[model samples]
Target: MRCLTIAGLLFLCYVTQGVKHFRLGRGKGGNLGAPGGYSGEKLPPAQWFKQRLDHSSPSDLRTWKQRYFVNDSFYDFNKQGPVFLMIGGEGPADPRWMVKGAWIDYAKKFNALCINLEHRYYGESHPTEDISVKNLQYLSSYQALADLANFITAMNNKYKLQRSVRWIAFGGSYPGSLAAWLRLKYPHLVYAAVSSSGPLLAKVNFMEYYEVVVDALREKTGGEDCVTELKSAHNQITAMMQTHPHIVEKEFRVCKPFEGASENDIKNFYNSIADDFADLVQYNEDNRISADVKYKNLTINTVCNMLTSPGSEPAYKKLAAFNSIILEKSNQTCLDYSYDNMIKELRNMSWGSEGARQWMYQTCTEFGFYQTSSGEIEVFGNQFNLDFFIQQCEDVFGKKYNADFVQASAEWTNSNYGALDIATTRVVFVHGSVDPWHALGITKTQDNDAPAIYIKGTAHCANMYPRSENDSSDLIEARVEIEQYLAGWLGLP
Candidate 1:
């Protein structure tokens, strides 16, 4: 789950009493990722609430049902206790986060109320009947933040918390960026924030994404042999796309033949394979499953072993087998190599359609986080550049979203939300050393209050996962330090 990290705020500073700032960093002494949190129990139900469609624009009076999950089992309404809120990510709102996250563990110990709020336009929070470019005008981070601010006010009024409750925000990936921005934009509203894997900067090209991906491969495995094989495999496909287009079609078993395929088509084919590996490494924990897999514990290391195995020789065969296995899990008989369909789905905006259009709009307009492999390193966010992005914007959202306008928007986003020049207090930035997103995040503390930390060799949002016996010692220490900070902030002694 990921979304644009933007928002607005009101002055609630004098409304509270004791909200302290926390400055914390990482624990240095272990491997990168830990096992995914194991659970076999059914969690609680989700409670939906009516949220304004555009809190930022008063003229556009529309409302949508925003989905939220709560665990007040530990809360005492009679007493003003802390609220551990999980800000939802790009995808649908999952109540499982309440149990899968670290906050629930903290909730029981601290007698806190745990809640997870779904982002607008994602999950069941569909504002309009359809997600046309015209309808999505209100789907910016600015509106989402306003929605959050208004939601807080409404929830407080409904529960009668006197607007003085301790509110601690938590999120990972894009949501992590939102958590940090929430505190920055609405300092008076949010008491504190724990932003894990939050990319703070807004840029058109995000090449460092792959740099870290390559680094993750080497660091996690303690060698470059695996990476070397992967790179070789990737290059082999590129060569095949050029010389033997027929073979490329036959082996990849694409929905359509590779004959007369444009430059974009070939690049997209490569991306299909590239993104699969990326999801594996990004969520590179033993218990973490691949993006689309029925295999319970499919992992990057295991996949890498398969790619480099003695029998899996020749890059084409390895790629074909890998694709076959992953697609078969979803009953996909043949790979859908239709970028045109990809474009169509990106615009469908239906409940079931992937949220590609919205995310692409965000990239073209707000942050050009395009993953071009040609940059410094090549792994994640690769295979494209500004030209392709510009063309896609025009095709997707009309002419207003040109490169000049997008570049300017990116600059303004950084300036407004403290992308490059962010100044803040009462927030701790958490990152994994091998996470590509951290290239934009605050890994190094510029100010005393905003201390960025890294769990060495870990992947994206690794610390955000629930603690397990298999968790690295460094991750355990990282969580402990975070708890200490939160406890001290709320004056829990």
Candidate 2:
């Protein structure tokens, strides 16, 4: 639900705002800071590291090349500076991260070498020939952590680095969890970790995700009126669907007529509309400078303004207008809420399956982060429940991946990783109050060693991005606290 497109899955899918996809720190070319002081004439090229296909199996000697990037522009060989490893998430590893991001800035100041490692099965780091269900068995967080451990060892050998040189892991979103877990699982390998907007807990019914969205709406200006209008609009749409189906179809501009649409199709339509709000809230005021100009300024304030705008037109019409705005900006003609079409897209086992199928597989097999609308007094109706998502898993993969299997998988993940009760030190957990993912993240500090920096009036991974004049004071202070923690761990002044 978090990192899925409507064509690929359901719930929180607005193309760009799919979970950790938007938090890649992608931006225009810029100059590298400090020691080497290189210009943006050429960014770091992608390098490949030979990784084991199955880290747990000694019999399986099969190996594959994993994509990665290295930026040693600020490395001080004489001083033996520390190393910063930025972990890639559910999306591709952008080379710009080597020169950009708050971590890169710290690397420059501390004269540390920077490296970005692409996760296996993501981007071009495929371990197998294809993404078939059998091949995907090797893809899991356990395997990914093993890859990092092996990679760090290989890097240490290649660079001939001393044991004093610290290794600080950095990641956002799912990779954020990886960063934290990397330190917890292999504390001897990783010196410290910065986990930003990382959800440590795995659960089947993530109804709290939508509740945070509603809270974010209320926190923004004119949000109360917008919430009222949105609830009224949903009721109106529901009534029209039962009485005049054609009117409902025309209002939302569905690709197919509602006359022959199945119950699943109707459910998909409601979920799609609800997802628009979820997407907006999840990534509100997050990395907007890199966003498209049309929607770059779009936020909860913008949506509230649109919904609360006074006019003779009904609330439902305003909601439709908002949907049309999104469609127009995305260059889409009609909203395709076809459940069958989604299944067809997910069933594609090709290499170019848009990262949706692979992420969905991870969700089904390991983390059951299905964002459902089963909460009481939810703005979005109860159309998207746990059953809806579980059915999707069965439809896309196989009947074997049913509710029982998913629940068991989630339990396994929590049992193996320790979930919210993860016992680790020198790990800084950073989260934004406005981001819905923060609900599953470590907002409060369990101890002094594992501190939490909960930034107010910010969105997902706000502190990870480069410094902006428009950033909130809390975000700026949070970054400072993170740097201090890293400095203390690295024995810096």
Best by lDDT: 2
Cα lDDT of model 1 by residue, 1-493, tens digit: 2322111001011211111000001100011122245356566787888888877667976777887878788899998799887776555665555555576777877888887787787656788888888788877777777777887777788788857798888877677877888888888889998988887898776666667778788887788877877777767777776688777677766777877667776566665666556555665663332223356456667777777788636966786777766555444556665556556656676666435566667666677776666563333234655566576677678888888888898888888897856777878899888767788888877776767777886776777667767778878888887787788878885
lDDT of 2 by residue, 1-493 (tens): 2321100011122443122221111101110111112236457898999999998988989999999999988997777899999886676666666676688778987899998888888777888889888988998899999999999999999998999889999887788888999999999999999988888998888888878878888887634787888888898888888898788788878888988887787777887888777767776776423224567677889888888889888888989988877655554577888889877877888887546677778889888888788873457889878888898899989999999999999999999889999999999999988888888889999899999999987876777777777778898899899989988988887
lDDT of each: 0.66, 0.77
Model 2 weakest lDDT span, ten residues long: 26-35
Residue 40, model 1: lDDT of: 61
Native-to-model Cα distance after best TM-score fit, residue 455 in candidate 2, in Å: 0.9
Candidate 2 ranges with C-alpha deviation above 4 Å: 1-41, 288-291
Error of 2 at 111 (Å): 1.1
Task: Give the CA lDDT, 0 to 100, for residue 326 in model 2.
Answer: 67
The true-versus-predicted C-alpha distance at residue 438 of model 2, in Å, is 0.9
> What TM-score does candidate 2 get on C-alpha atoms?
0.92
Q: Model 2 Cα displacement at 469 (Å)?
A: 1.5
Q: Please state every model's RMSD to the true fold in angstroms.
A: 8.9, 5.0
Per-candidate total of colliding backbone pairs = 10, 0
